[model samples]
Target: MMPLRTIANRVECEIEIKKSRFVGVVDRAATEADARAVIAAARMSDPAAGHHCSAFIVDSSAGDPLADPKQQRIERSHDDGEPSGTAGMPMLEVLRGHHTTNVVAVVSRYFGGTKLGTGGLARAYGSAVSEALVHARFLTRQRREIMTLELDHAEVGRVESELRRHAVLVLGTSYAARAVLTVSAVDADSTAALVASLTAGRVTPVRSGHMYAEIPD
Candidate 1:
């Protein structure tokens, strides 16, 4: 299978002014729509802000021809009454500068009453976005296939322990005549290894298919 796409867990950046404050939020998004939704939500938090300009980059899953090979992405800036290019372009540059992908960044500004002019606005916006990014916490994602393991009561403990040792996620368990375990592992190799080791070459797992989750930091 192809490599999994990249994503961000969280990122923070802030900009300071002699008077006003502008904050930027960087977050991972799965789709174009998801990215826009995050931007909208960010704006709602500070509806009174003078401007909320943002940028985003989203790459499609493997084999998605429509996805831009370059990085499915978007960058939009709202002047929020500020002169055009003064707010959005700088924010876009910051996102691009950081090589951020599958992510969206929104910078909200509350005017300080003093005009910073074009250069000042650009610097302020970029600086604020950078600060927010500095504060971000992030996790890389991995692709995995999910499987449900059914084992007899006598074998459940052995299976669970082995899976744990291999870093498999036992999402949940159901106890009936047999123990049903929801297992998630990074790849088919890992899954097969765990099953072979846990079942002692007796039982085989039923794979559910591919899914994704953040690799623990």
Candidate 2:
């Protein structure tokens, strides 16, 4: 699966153009519902704002296994009462230009008794989002396999220490009849080989599943 870029934290920026105030919020949205929820929250926080224009690009494959393969991404933008192309599309273009996905940006406009015309509105909206993204921290979400290494309690600690030395991400260890060490792995083949070599064929790692794990951008 392809690695995607997204905001690491929610960021908001305020910019005034021609007396119109634009407040933009950019956040991580792992799913379509998450994107809509962020937009809704933005509106509720600024109920008196004239317009809450929003744009989002979500990689459907990151969360939904049943998502249509032909549609790997879900992109949406809304004008929210502004002129047709003045608000949403321009914000979306800025997001795409920044190569951001699984992210949502909403620019709430507070009318300043000034009409900036369609072209001005587009530039303001796009610029607002762009500025917020500039101050926003970002990360890359990449597909990683989660594996469970079942081992005897006595051997678990030593094995885990050894694995960590090899640069493996050990998530956690759960106790049961045997110790189960959950880890975010590079791949199944590499994990299996490491486990086999570590325990001399006494243990085999089980593939739990796959998930998109955040990494440094």
Candidate 3:
């Protein structure tokens, strides 16, 4: 699967329309429980807010909260107390258009004694999320196989430099009787080959596991 895009940190944006205040919060959430937790935090931050609408999309490659393997993606939206289809649906559409995954958005409304009609509410909610996203930092998430290589301390600096020259991502290194280096790569075999060549067939890498890593977007 191709790498997915998500926010690097939580962000909030606010807008006022017809005296009604709308505040939007955006964050990365890998599961339904995480999304709910984010919503709860947003509500706690603004206890006096009238409505808290929410939307989210989870990638299937990550653990599926719904436990449906057939569904590669999960999506949900809530209108809160706003008119039907006005608050949540538009916010969800913005996420879809951006091709974002593992993301959740919540819009909190503080009534200002004036009511916006359904159309106005939808635009306001959508705009709130859109503006928040504009200020958010994005990251690309991809699955990579992790490998560990053990070598004599003498070979550590040379091997590490060669690995960087080949664009290998070095996660960390530990100094022990033998130096142990942890790395991640898109292709394990290719990474092993590179390491072997760099060490002149004196070192080999063992597969540890797989995990997702964030890359600059």
lDDT (CA) per prediction: 0.71, 0.87, 0.86
- Local distance difference test, candidate 2: 0.87
lDDT per residue (tens digit) for residues 1-217 in model 3: 4456788888889999988899999998877788889999988998999999999997655663223322477899999988889989999999877777889999999998987888889999999999999998888766678889999999889888888877778999999899999988878999899988888898889998876666778
TM-score of each: 0.65, 0.79, 0.77
Q: Where in model 1 is the C-alpha error above 4 Å?
A: 1-21, 25-49, 56-77, 92-104, 110-120, 175-177
Ranking by TM-score: 2, 3, 1
Top-TM-score candidate index: 2
Ranking 1 against 3 by TM-score, winner: 3
Per-prediction CA RMSD (Å): 5.4, 3.4, 4.0
Model 3: worst 10 consecutive residues (lDDT sum):
62-71
The deviation in Å at residue 87 for candidate 2 is 1.1
Residue-wise C-alpha lDDT for candidate 1, range 158-196, written one tens digit per residue: 888888887887878899988888888877676776687
Residue range 88-126, candidate 2, lDDT tens digits: 999999988877788999999999998999999999999
Backbone atom clashes (below 3 Å) for every candidate: 10, 0, 0
Q: Which has the higher lDDT value, candidate number 1 or candidate number 2?
A: 2
